[model samples]
Target: MLTDLHKQLLNDFQRDFPLVERPYLEIANRLGVSEDEVLSALAELRDNRLISRVGPVIPPNQIGASMLVAMAVPEPELQRIADIVSRFPEVNHNYEREHRFNLWFVAVASTTDHLARVLDSIERETGYLTQRLPLVNDFFIDLGFRLDLSHA
Candidate 1:
């Protein structure tokens, strides 16, 4: 169950999230509530699977090396390998495609060497070879989801 606060929080702060020492507190102030209320609501939203995570979405390869990696994982091993890949903090997200190289993901690191190390570790652990596709151009993709919270 979501309240007006939760709806507003989700809809208003998708972009231009306050970059402050106490962002939640700032949001609380803006919403005319105590910081604890905002945190509690956010926690409740997380617990109910209404939200996934809160973090900055930096441009790819801006502060580090970024790679679009793919793996030809057998169908039986897909879920397990995906779980292993998701454990790495460098991996943003992963998905499956209806192709031989079905498992695809993006990984970012502070440096090219660090990215290589992460890929190497993935290969060593999963026993699957990594195929990194080079970035030839940049495209802007909006990352916000406009929730329809009318029922809330």
Candidate 2:
């Protein structure tokens, strides 16, 4: 179940995230909670899949190259391939979709050549043809969400 603390975290930390060496410590201070408490709460939320991750959301093309990649894996090999793809450090978000190109993921690297190498490695390891869709323009990017735990 969602709690007020979780709501506050979801709302407050979505943007202007601390970039210091000890960010969680800074967050704990700001939230009037112990560092351990903040850490435990984040771990609980992640373990329950309430949030995909707790990390910086760098603007696209700001620091590194990123691409939306998809692969059509046979039903039997889906789990194995997904596991393989997820093992890469470059892969941030991966999910299964109800479409011909079922497995989709986002990969980011320091440069375009590095991004290509990651994709190539995934293709070689999984033997699946990956479709790379590089971003041409930024239409809309909303990484923040307000969760009302009061209703929960």
Per-prediction backbone clash count? 0, 0
Q: What is the lDDT of residue 87 in candidate 2?
A: 100
Instruction: Please report how far candidate 1 places residue 16 from its true position, in Å.
Output: 2.6
Superposed Cα deviation of residue 87, candidate 2 (Å): 2.7
- Local accuracy of candidate 2 as per-residue lDDT tens digits, 42-148: 88888988777898766777898999999999989999999999999999999999999999999999999999999999999999999998888886577577666
- Candidate 1 stretches with Cα past 4 Å from truth are 19-26, 76-92, 117-129, 141-143
| Count of backbone collisions within predicted model 1 | 0
- TM-score versus the correct structure, for each prediction: 0.67, 0.66
lDDT of 1 by residue, 1-152 (tens): 67888898788888877899999999999989999998998888888888776677767787888999999999999999999999999999799999999999999989999999999999999999999985777876776877788876
lDDT of 1: 0.89
For TM-score, the strongest prediction is 1
- Shift in Å, residue 148, candidate 2: 3.2
